[model samples]
Target: MSINVFAGSRKALVASIALAAVLGSVTASSAVLAADALSTASTTVTLSAKINGFTNTDWLNGVWRAAPALSIPASTANNAAFKVGASVRLADGQVRKVTKVYVVGSNLSVFLDGAVVDGNKVGAPNVLSAVTIATATTSPTTSSPTTSSGSTTTVSSGIAYASGINNFTNTDWLNGVWRKSAGFSIPATSASKSAFIVGATVKLADGQLRKVKTVQVVGSNMSVFLDGAAVNGSVVGYPNKLTAVSGSTTETAITAPTQTTLATSGLNNFTNTDWLNGVWRKSAGFSIAATGANQAAFKLGNSVKLADGQVRKITAAYVSGSNMSVYLDGAVLDGNAVGYPKTITAISGTSTSTGTVTSPAPSAPVVSAPAESTAPADTTNGQPRLVGVNLSGAGFGPSVVPGVHGTNYTYPAESYYKKYADLGMKLVRLPFLWERIQPKLNTPLNATELARLKQSLDFAHKHGVKVILDLHNYYRYFGKLIGSSEVPISSFAGVWKQIVQEVVSHPAVEGYGLMNEPYSTNGLWPQAALAAAKAIRTLDSQRWIYVAGDRWSSAYHWPHYNTQLINDPWMRDRKNNLVFEAHMYVDKDFSGNYFDKAEVFDPMIGVNRVKPFVEWLKSNNLRGYIGEHGVPDFSPSAIVATDNLLAYLRQNCIPSTYWAAGPWWGEYALSLDVTSGKARPQLPVLQKHAKTANSCSSIGPL
Candidate 1:
């Protein structure tokens, strides 16, 4: 699996937490001060200038640059008259609290809370009105305290105060309540030192009130619980202020929004629309009538105008309840969820006359093989002649490089080779980390790792399975990407040269996959792949060389990123033994994780995604292969999609390998491993399409 795919869900969750902290703050209090009462000094300023630009500083904050640079008081730390935690009103009449105050080369830049709009966290340029700053006053007021009989008197105030409020960093939205993580300090100087009891109410910096639920003080730091999540547009962190409100702690009842089923008919006659909350709905208008079986009007490939007024064809459509959602050309318009149809200006190719249209049945398309003139004379009607599964265990545990052989990561057992070969699978794509094979860049291959790799090749040779040596590194070695000063292209080429020198004569070695999925921001993968291929050619010119494209080698994006490989003269192989490799997945994120059944909403998803790559190969007369593709065994729709995808590949004479079969993938949804002598659900599908022809000789002229 792609590392990016594995970490996609985690990255999203972290972003949600950061967003909540910026939009609102949780209030809880503990301890009280007995010393003289402290009063805070504050100042307010109004500016009539409009915001000319906005820039995002980070996930939780952004800077609003005033037009023509507004002159304001110095915002340095010593000048507490104007600093962070200041509240400001925008020209649009919206109030926001400042998180940072700085000058960008004489232009005042006020950093404030940020919100996500159109799938990105960005600041909107608005007019500036006023900014208010507050500072603790130096002067103090004395207050007398009551004393017990015959005991020394101690000064105390009945009000509670929480100090070190600025140190609270993390926030979470739990049970509809936004809460600050524990470990914040409460100074023991206030009069009512323990007034932060349960059921107490405290007011946050933004003036929003919250009720206390639990209070636990561990030494100086206290963990106090608050009621209710952060309100939208509320600021989280305040520099030096947290005031306890004196009142009864009565909880407010929150009402849930009512769920209503809207109409889905007359969607083809939309006037205006917008994509919001991962669905396309009417921006402003009344709901249309509900769509029944007799009134269905939209099909899979009808062209319609979106909110932006651009016409796009619908690739998939389905109705859930009374709302209908459509996907345009397989594009994930907003996350994985499809768009709910709303009012639009026009929709073409569907008859609205009689209010009756045919809705496409959720079934796989019948794809026929096209005649291939470029195929060799012996090619069997352009059918895919090689099918197999990836033997994936040596690539696990990437964090522990050069780890223990079996405990951290292991190689596929010899029995796997015999078992798969007996099932008519003659190809095996073996994934191994480059760092494990060559521990140090531009250095000799590790003896133990090299020996272990050779043993797998020997097993392949014994079982008559052709092996593709796949370097399962994502264009990096030890966290450093290729083409960087630390890891140059020469180092990448050097490793391939050494690998080829060791395994060139092995009969099972069908090809050398330079890299598994080269995703780099420096745009140097094409050059690095060309250099690696040249290095391997110098050692052995007959073996095929497979070059994977950037962006995880996604088949859907092959034409956009890999067309340069076909046009560049330096990338040409003298022996014509080069093959392009790409990967495809039916899931919405293309991660191949398939955590949800809705990911495979359309049965023809696989065929639609791989069409571009297949067309690119046929049009350019180039040899192409699918290096990785799989579907979860639990989803029947996903299985049908996989079958359709394999059938399309066979028609186009392109081979593919299932994502995996390894001893370590226990309970993995895509694994082909047998459990308790019962075959996995996806195993029969692979067995039905298994082919053993010499793919290299059969696809193109040799």
Candidate 2:
């Protein structure tokens, strides 16, 4: 018998063979040669300005598809900690053994037993995954069993047994013929004189097992009840090669098996500082401050300590077909992997034919309905809530675009919208660059540009996703600020004038984000925001207009009394239709530049950080939206922070959208792409929030 295994490199594979010899070799040599190569190890871990958690299912799901390589950054000092044969866990909960370790330039790469991570060099976070150092590495010793069966071998009770051929004097099957049977009924006795009881296990000639639901014997006519119908056949006088098992078997009512699944959120807690300096210890508790990485583990319906050392129980966990849910105090916590792996492996035991029979084939309906929605139900009213991710490809090109930037952007297919729709997403923040809308100043919208944008909007609308056309230029145009004399505010407004006319009344076009992350230091951003808002208002008065702040539209900077753009008088008009927008990122410095924390549990950083901005909107009776916020792909703290942020948003009836979910963010430090097509450690968080906030009260009429 042969089993397949994955390793990081040839050398690692050799080490794996040695490790397997100790672990009692589960895989063959052919499988050992299938090790995938990873990038050679380098000196440091790569650092980038990447956020986490928020993933878009449209462009790419979170599943990791390619071979994985370690992209160790030049700054990482604990290179010795990671070695061939070390145990590591991927973001999707799969544990793998390291095969080979490579050092190329300043980066470190390796091969894993299974390649669950992406193998990219550019822009990817080059950090080793969570590692489990064995206390004392030792090899396995193989052993074999020797036993013999006696005349009367004990049939151990509670032990599962197969029902092919078994010797039992009490339980014996005699040949029987088909007869015209009616209602299900138990026979008084067997034709061979053995008791034909209801609980007796009987196997037909084809090896299918069925209990006597209601066996009937009418003058040598016999009927076996199964599948809610009775089988009619004539009873045979003798057991002619016909078999039957004595003991009953019960496989249903089994809970899913316990498996150690890891979430790719937080990096290794025991890093160089902790390992070399011997300062890894922290106050043991549930809070992020108290607990270090790998200190705890959980699954659906499990319990764990909170940041404050408070033991909290998982309120609910249930799997229905493909949909699985996990609740904390009745509120949904995102990232519950339901139906991915069958929780309960069917166990064979004694059968109990207590009236109702288990499905004869032992297979329940895997899918409740074809194309049934896994998304949450629609809101009470007709208007649906706008809970979704952003699609970010059209805005990828040159920020200062007089010089051409790369044009490798591709429009998403209709399948993308359908994918999100299936996940209960009703809103999409579609970001396209101003350069694409107008290649040169005062030029007509390009034919390809219009068609592509229109195609995206049409497809999204057709699939029930509302579109939010976002001009993601950061308030700059070809190296010129919007309000600067070089590119007057009118030029920016003119672009909207063309765009607004084209999509003003489209049913799917819910609103227009004037600009993404405007960072104008001067007071030019307020003027730019108003210019675009008024331009759109002229074309359509009722549609919502989103206006961002000056300093990157940051939530931390939104309420700065002196520089805040939301306080501008021009933004107060059409109050109900105008939504102030701001973005938030949580780290030690309130920037999404690093992913060092194992988890984030502080209300100060998670909820308190955004409280001021949300409160400002409430005090002014203004509605607002979180235009962008996301956590890292491999941090538990990121997940906690994102959940806290979203919970706060929903509690205050504020609507928000997650940042940069498109497939273009390959290996970006904050990408949620667990795979090329599926998301992990992030999608569950999004789904949990979407399903919990079932009310569309936050979203007004279109």
Candidate 3:
């Protein structure tokens, strides 16, 4: 924008005449040939307009610098001449002022500020010629701002508590520039928490724009995870304008949907103490923060696994104030450093993928359990079917009962062993100690103890009943009490191998019960137990091995096969030599009993009054056996199904060792007087059941 200033020169006169000739058929460049070219030019000619060889040119790239006529002052005309402020516009898109006025001859040359050609005219090639300035006014200079560098994302806080700000402004207001479609879909299979990316926009419940989240699906869920760093960000009213030419204008914007991010680890966030502590894993699909009404750890609408990866691959997540977060694909190794608001990063392990994720349709609900086989082997007549009992082994006892078992310190007497066979006991249970045999590392079994153990085994052989040797106490325990299954595997396995070697030759010992209730969790217990199984198999192939589950004696399914804990020949069990064990206490550490005293609480049915744990045991390869279960005398319905419980035992055609033979042993330990010779009412039930159990031998299901 500029004001025109010129001197007395022929340039101004020729410019006016050429402006007039562009509207006519006459050539405006005739003045250069016969001093007559002053017409046939565009009405808005630039002050430095170049008349290249003079034909009407296509170089119209300048702005007009004159004010509207409404702002003009009335001035007297002298000999058809008018005086007005001069505002010059050049072909380069720059508009300024021109002061000098000039009139040379019939072929006039234009000048500004009493000077000749202060700026250049750009028309056609070598055709820069102006006639005169007719109506002129003052032009002003104006400008606006625009982005020189591209937009970027920034986190105001640390990664642990990340926030997002896209299309964000400092002022508090709802901006529509950033919003996600109500039913937008992202890549994830299971419920998940997604990481937000920069430069993208998402819509909030308040209709404001936020950071957009791009996610990946991993292991039955989305790989997208949050980087905890969100501090402050929001929707701004407007964007800074552009400078230079005012031709095109655009505003920066970002709109996104409300997504959930989660930190799927650490026990502090949950109040339930019994809940297992571990990474719940971020699966494929969409994940919402704990902010919205439907915020959850998982969010799978239509998730599928990608071609290169396995099923939905989930990862770990961290916390960021209120938002939950998970990082996948592009995540860092330490898992702590992800660029803020960025969705999934690097990834390891397998991935899960599927369709879109949204709030409209919910994902399928999943229950934590191990996969099971479709069918189990049939039990036939006298085929040594799977059967056992939970001894509820006592932690305290006087001298062990003699002659029924091997070196186990706690035992039922030799006479009791005979009684067991008399009443048809097939498997005698004995839960022993972690503090005894290998008390501090390489300790060997004592001679006196070994002698006692042989005496007991001889007695069992004299009668007829298989003796099960259980490594009841893991070496990690300091005393008779149980320690965590988290002890180092090397020490535990070393001791386990020694114990296995000791019992391999014992004819009375039918099997070696591996770690009692080893957790199937992602830990060393299972791995170490499997190692012990390998050692046992290597030492004595004929004997069977028992392995218990993880928490709560979970026997359904064990850990993943990839754990490689089970040594070689894992699938090579032609002997059907493996038995998985479970211990069922009443719900809540002893809740109401499903059946009264005599009735059986078969977990085969659903989980109700009875524990459904036994069915879970069969789900994984291997037979199910109750290592521990009992009824309290306090239970009012003691003898209700004493008949059915006994009948069912017989119908299954499986052997069960009664929990007690000694008058005051085991459950009686806490109640009955040790010196009391009285019998528990359940003894009669066991005797009756044992008598009837043989009936199923001929009428077997198989």
Candidate 4:
């Protein structure tokens, strides 16, 4: 089974691939344009222009536009000469692709893709030229070649055959052939047999056009010979071509939807209202309503036009008992408050389609997340302020389960406990592999691994830091899920029972994290968690138990998938000492990898993602803990977001640990570990939020 491990090795590989893909797609097209080299096509326009200024109304949505309107020729203005996908070359030698273009009167506004890196100097004092490519007049013909008994047939003058083909090797194209490489394989499916037939004009990554000369296929392997070797430019492989701009004879004015107050009571009392098609459309105005019946409309794949005028797709949504909370493409809408009715003047009809495309609309005003809630009003007196970092290294080399301790995976250094404790962090989340501790199912803990864990705990106690025993297994044992017949619930519970018996009396031990980011494919995590908690209580009744919900224990998804933990009687902890744990990341995909620079950072993203989980805890009267949360140090906005998130957690009287700190995490973006005798950039942010209190009196109940 391919489990999503929390180690940096896998994340680094993913980041590398993502970075390469981005570079391969955009590097070739983003070259500096040569003067007087514009395409001769009638649709392409080269104009001398000056950049007046810049505007960043909706930069997150790629709405950063050049300010002060530029004069547009009357003849070209009506032809949609500055439409999206047009190439723009500024006088300062910077080239950008047009994302949006607006025309009013004789003035033109051009929105460009990318962030405002150089301030006012970006496109200043220079003539701007735009090339609007027209759509193809004719489609590529599809003609299959006739095959003779033992001879291969060549196809000429037809569309490039790309059916059933996922991707191609970058180096193969340079060799005038498309052959299977070590990094890639040609599909063996019948549909792929016709792909890349000879004579098909295939466009290379650098926009160069070429034709196939010959083709061969043998089972799962295939090779296509091109007429000539393709040049491997800055863009290494196939390019994702830009959309063509179509001309419009008539000019259309884009206007913002007028706001009108609805007659209904809004979200104040959602249960008393009726929901239709996922929205409550009154005669006066429109309001999005959340209920069980129309819950599908507010789901992840759905889109919504918020009051701010931005059309955003829902990344996540949870509706329960007339209450609804949703994330607008990872940004929390209305602090993710349940039943916090989003009263808007207008709303698009509930769309089942996942695409976020919409007709051109006026730029939406920028809006930040709701102001951080004050802590004094909500936080109970004497609540524990547990702040710390996740001490890693012990859970490494998961692929080599039960591998040699020092050679494959080693425990974190005992000195890290004092280093973090001196930094005012008193709680340490120690992650170790379950397979290493208990090599066999339902067996006693491994003596060597158990001793190593005890030594780490002893060091933590010496530094007066509490430890949360984090079982860094994704609710799996040897690639099998907890509830699977291969790894039964009894075996999982038995392992926990043995672990508690060994460390229940340790002074440094704070709680038993039942499992790290449990992902139960068969919906068996809740049952498995309850069973483990019961077994732990039979031995140690006082130590708190941390139970993570399903789906990688994502904070934004808690209400959607973990409500059963509160509603189902069987899933409840018998001792009422369970503290629900969730993890949140501020990246676009919530994967903690910050490889894409185009994904604009929003400071409220951290608050937005964790609000649903915090609200869920408050509504259910349960204690909560953030087991994992961190941001890359390179992003200033991400650092600010982390500070805001930590403040929000402090205000709510909830404790959290930054992920993570260890000797082995060299140059890790989110690592708080000291490097070259200097603290990492993210360490000071953790220090600012770290608290000395170690008591859990403030947090209670499962």
Per-residue lDDT tens digits for candidate 1, residues 1-702, read: 554655223212322332233334301123221110111214355444344343432111222121111223233421242233334554433344443343433344443332211101223343444554343323232232111111122222223564435343322322212232211234434332455544344545444445443343333444444433223212534354445644322111111111121222334332232334334331111222335631243433244444433343333333333444444421123311222343443243321111111112111111111112111111221222457889987887676787778766789888898788767676789999888998888889998999899899877755546788999888889879999999999999999888877765444577888998777537888888888988886756445688898888889888998877766775653334688899988777777766676554577888899888888877776777899988877898888888877776765557788987866665556778733345587877777777422222234311
Tens-place lDDT per residue, model 3, 361-380, is: 10111111000111111111
The C-alpha RMSD in Å for every predicted model, in order, reads: 29.5, 28.1, 39.9, 22.6
Comparing 1 with 4 on lDDT, the higher-scoring candidate is: 4
Off by over 4 Å in 4: 1-383, 570-575, 674-678, 692-697, 700-702
lDDT of the structure predicted as candidate 2: 0.45
User: What TM-score should be assigned to candidate 3?
Assistant: 0.37
lDDT of 1 at 614: 81
Q: Which ranking of candidates, highest lDDT first?
A: 4, 1, 2, 3
Error of 1 at 690 (Å): 0.9
TM-score of 2: 0.45
Residue ranges of candidate 1 with Cα displaced over 4 Å: 1-384, 570-574, 674-677, 691-697, 700-702
lDDT of 4 by residue, 222-318 (tens): 4433322123322423333211111111111101122222222244333322223233211111224454433545443334544444444343333
Per-model TM-score, in order, reads: 0.46, 0.45, 0.37, 0.46
Q: Name every residue pair that clashes in candidate 4.
A: none
Global lDDT scores for all candidate models: 0.53, 0.45, 0.32, 0.53
